[model samples]
Target: MALTFEFETEKVIQPWRTITSLDTTLLKNWAKQRLDDAHHYNMQSNMKERLKEDVLKQYVKSSEILISVANRHCESTVSGMFKSVLFILTSAEGIVLSVSGPQELVNTLNRNHNLGPGSVFTIQNAGLNAISISIELMDWVYLTGAEHDFKLFKEWDCFCSPVRQNGEIIGYLDMSFSVQEDHLLLAGLFAFTLKSIEEELGKQDQQKSIYEHFQTYRLSPREKEIGYFWLKNYGALRIASELGLTEGTVRNVVKKIYRKTEVSDKGQFIRKFLNGLI
Candidate 1:
């Protein structure tokens, strides 16, 4: 719906009709910033190329969890009825880590838009995309219709949110659909996905902490493996069979692990491992 008109004779501006009033203001500000930067929408044409190894090495470490979590969720959900949606994960600096969708959508995005894994989005290249703008604003952003700088993307609806850790933006999670049928629906989905990614990251952190606590006991790699299996309630025979060791050898290792860890029984060992005290 057109909120107002600059001139009654002029056709309604597409963004005025599509985006909320607040978002329109934000869009205008972003446009002004682009102009101020002397950045054209398509100026960074080479961004679609593979990210340099050195660049990735420098940037992807902190975002690895976000990338992994987003990729896992997208792979499981971005098919069947959701096949038209493209889910993208990009680093804080807008380096694309992965793009997931049906092959048809993937091909279309790649061929027409130069969007694929390893693509970069920056003030120089991406002109007001969900990913690019979210990077700029560090907030949730939705871009569709004429708000997109490129005509090729105007028909697609994009929803993106900043992925954060330690209260700082680490990357972005973006989903693009060919049509603008459901902004609110996609927004809810994006929020839920972000929550799930954060939860998964918490689990990863806890697991790492637990592993580090376990390492403080100076267990060898093999003993650590055996201890993990032991904590899982595997019998000595099963552990030996799985690890290709004789049962006697496995039993000896288990004894050493118990002594070194100071656990008198399986229950105590399990408790200590779970509490990260061993």
Candidate 2:
């Protein structure tokens, strides 16, 4: 769905950075404008039926890492803050991939609001809500109470941040709760959650690159294994213990890896093997 809003400047606004700086009046005005446009278009308040099971499975598989991290964050951090909370992870297109939180609350939302996996939250399907707005703006958004365009969501205070990988938006991470007094603080907390997920994703990407780069050395599986641990600063005794091998064996493998990679020590090995990969 196409919803347009006129801004004072052509430059894109980074809403999260400016969120604290924006006055209450200005923030309300921005939400008001979006709600007005949503009302003008007469957008649907209720979400449509979810996608097919196979299609939904594909989305879930593609976002496996994102889903894992989001759920971990919810369980370890967000769930401790409230008795009942909903964390929703959605694809770039706004189709739900996973929902994490209290089981009863998740069931209620799925049965009553059609909010389970595969449910679409785009502007066309679910009206002007946090997920839809975040996808549209490609930034962070928080909508509370009547600020929501749909009456169904008026009781929910939702905070959403677009999950980006390699500078491209891959999905959205959203946390919603019944209207509460600490909504603003919750928004900040959600931002922290997103930041952690993004940082973890970046580290994984770096590790993957390093693994692929190692392939050019033509080392055996064992050599590669020992080399990786050695490069990470693991001592021979530690690597041997972890791999269930003798320290002498691990040291021998490490020596072969160093010679094969044309490096004498860990410092040189890292400098030569991981020059541009890291």
Candidate 3:
């Protein structure tokens, strides 16, 4: 059976409502309260030293898949008119993992605002910008101009949403650009990009589940290798060609896998795997 991925468009698209139907009065009051809280904590707008190279490498490696998906989306979908916009990915704790967009725009933001990999954007570090506030609320947020507590972000509009995997927030994706007439369309695109990221994460979880479940079967290394392809619906001839084995050997391995997995046939194996009965 082919892998199946499903996501509710309505649920994924719901966060854009925060942008289109924004309540200025309430947002202003909230921004004021956040600013007051930042003042109480004596937060500074100055850029702090970024994470050490080794530490930053680990965070980037952990978010490799997320960064890859975001980069592809930016290149394919967010180019042209949105080229100046910066897509920032940060760890759940708010350390920037990667920044992608127009090369000139990325460089400008890095030089002027310290918006680059390893830079921290937690509430304590970056005050009340969209990334920090989204982390605080664990939800999507849109902040523009005066809504930001820092002078650096006063000329930009930011839309941010948390990226989750296995029902837990793993990181955040933020799109920031200078104020523009197409702000609403930009926000919609940001939401769609986030939905794509989460969908890929969901598929990763399913693949991981398949690997872990296979581990419990006590199959040998070779058996496990062949069994994986079988579970993915690979026929004996294709599995043999892919694995560089004779078709007879591949068929023999499949029979052994069926016996070990207690499944009478390929269909039974797939059904059991999908239902978590394996």
Candidate 4:
């Protein structure tokens, strides 16, 4: 996750120096405006692609495609030299788009972001602390849940940069290291990986096709039945009793079913099961 330092637009022209300006806050409003402009550019760039604003659930499983792209990038470019890298793919409102990195880190991000149901801070929220609180970090938090939000960023010593596509915020790539000077290489890696991630998400969106992409989450018979019952407004107690099962056992089964369905709560389980994550 990128911590918000400060941005200063007037200081430099070089892209490298421009990106790591310790004086990041100076660029504030103008930078935000630029992001909006970037988003407009992105929309125009992908304007030709099918838009399913009403269909595709933002960031639900974007990671499947996103992580695949990030993995290939690390293996090919860094050769695991990243040692520790975390890639978070998110939508415009800060919802996790996809995720990958060291398995442990990924798990930690997921646990903290909790990008399942009743999540606010849409994909765009990712760009909130554009210079600091990476779009990927916000989105990851929306997806996985967080031990804390943007408050603890600096303490972690991670620099966050937004990953954009055609100008729109898609996700971000992050690295955690103790030394502030390491920001140079770490920042560079974020930029490169960000590009790869953007390209991959676009390709995945094009090649897989949403319908086919989401087909991987086929629900089981038991899970389906239980889900259907729950959706019909039956609580755990009622459903379990009717099914001649103990409430605790039923609850455990429900938890497993939820995991199987990739849902954070009952509402999303029903929505995804019946309609879609979109």
Candidate 5:
């Protein structure tokens, strides 16, 4: 709904709708920061291009490419850039995504730090003996794993960007370096990776919005396939035709899936799907 503007229109001069002396400077800085980040952010198409075309064509087909590319790039380009070996590792809960650095760094990580295995994490390291650890970073410790990524990286002289998947922070992508370059640049890249992956995942998820958790017990292949289609809004007729089953058969199958999943209707099923508790 459009917000009704009841205030007197004192604008005739400023371009922004809401502005005050303090807000004016803040708004300008915020806009400038956004512009700067956008410049460095790999444009959507450009990011698509970053993937090997064949790979993009293959994996992104079902939208699995989001995690694939993030993990892959971390293992390949990002890792090579860091002069490290990388892995497609998940956090303790299989929620966060991470690319652990090369051999020595990995050894270091395992030996010393847990770099957080929690949801929602942060890290920063400036090369000097003097350091600034913000409350934002500290508050995140219990929220996610920071011991390894934030604390250890600070100890080893590296920087980390924690990736959040499905609203839960999963893991941190830590890079060990000798000197500080641009932490913001690295942070921005990871941010873009997260956003791109999240968008694809969100769309894929919507397609399976129905009965994700309810049907978890023991789904037959046909039941699973039928569920996939139904969540996507495919009717019995469409699903039957697509799966080479009779409409009557598809309806029977869905009833069983619902029974197994424990949900009576599509609404409850979708709620479970989004939480990922499924």
Candidate 6:
């Protein structure tokens, strides 16, 4: 689980006055050195299919809450606050986990940026995205149209901030909009939203330890079978089918599980079970 990495020596000081004077020349150069035209075309052409088998699938169990909260925030923002904003969530490594916005705005990003889950934004692949920049810079960053090195995103602006848990960066949240939108306001909003996410993640961490202790408790064979699927986030019907039992039987077992685990509802049961509370 311990992967090693090294970042190039780039200036920590940020430039505010002129786009041309920004300290991103090294990022543009790195992008050019890491990929070529064919790589770019391949990524854009097959991104949708690649999303089905992303490396982040293992992290999905814990990330579900993060993605849910972010999507809800995205829906609320786009419904009235910002008409053209598209929110993107990415893992610490820059691999996108989810994207949300109005259908028209989403479609435009898909068409132009191949925006989708499993897509990676990095200096090595795509040049100068808010998510990648924020992670690299370890701070909030707003990239305006002409500030980007990639021609594909020359007319777009982005506000990005990193999401942290236990003082370590875990992911990134990005809000992209057209050049006419208010970048400064959006960046401040992103910072506030990130703080909320960080607080939620902290609670989840506390709950996870409680659930892990529950895993040591003993269970009957049938209960163990069902619990196995439950831990994987499988639904009752799906669990029944895979275990060759009826849905009613699955539900009955779940009821017994709830009683034994001292949980009242599916949400409590699932959170505890997945976290190891049961």
- Candidate 1's displacement at residue 276, Å, is 8.5
Instruction: Identify the leading candidate in terms of TM-score.
Output: 2
Residue 164 in candidate 2, Cα distance off native in Å: 1.7
lDDT order, best first, reads 2, 3, 1, 6, 4, 5
Question: How well does candidate 3 match the true structure in TM-score terms?
Answer: 0.74
| Whole-model Cα lDDT of every candidate shown, in order | 0.72, 0.77, 0.77, 0.48, 0.44, 0.70
Question: By descending TM-score, how would the candidates be arranged?
Answer: 2, 3, 1, 6, 4, 5
Query: Per-candidate TM vs. native?
Result: 0.69, 0.79, 0.74, 0.38, 0.35, 0.60
Sequence-dependent TM-score of model 6: 0.60
RMSD of each: 8.3, 9.4, 9.7, 18.6, 16.1, 13.0
Q: Which lDDT tens digits does candidate 2 get at residues 169-236?
A: 88899888889657765766677788888888887777667667677888887787787787778999
Model 1 segments beyond 4 Å from truth?
1-29, 35-66, 80-83, 165-168, 225-255, 265-278
List model 6 lDDT by residue over 31-141, tens digit each. 564456534533342232234564658656557877777677667666776357778888787778888888876777677657777777876566556666777777777
**Clash totals for all models, in order?**
0, 0, 0, 44, 10, 6
Candidate 6 residue 258 C-alpha distance from true site, Å: 19
Better of 2 and 6 by lDDT: 2
In candidate 6, where is summed lDDT lowest over 10 consecutive residues?
41-50
**Deviation in Å, model 4, residue 122 alpha carbon:** 7.8
lDDT of 5 by residue, 1-278 (tens): 88887777664442111112234554344334332243232221111112244543443343344456566555554543643323333332222234345656555543454322221221112111111111223111111122222232332233333445566443334434433355334444444544555565556555454444434667876787888777767889999999888999999988887788787877665554445534
After superposing candidate 5, which stretches have Cα over 4 Å from the reference? 1-73, 76-99, 112-176, 200-208, 213-220, 226-278
Name the runs in model 6 displaced over 4 angstroms: 1-33, 37-62, 111-113, 210-278
**Where does the lowest 10-residue lDDT sum fall in candidate 4?**
140-149
The TM-score of candidate 2 is: 0.79
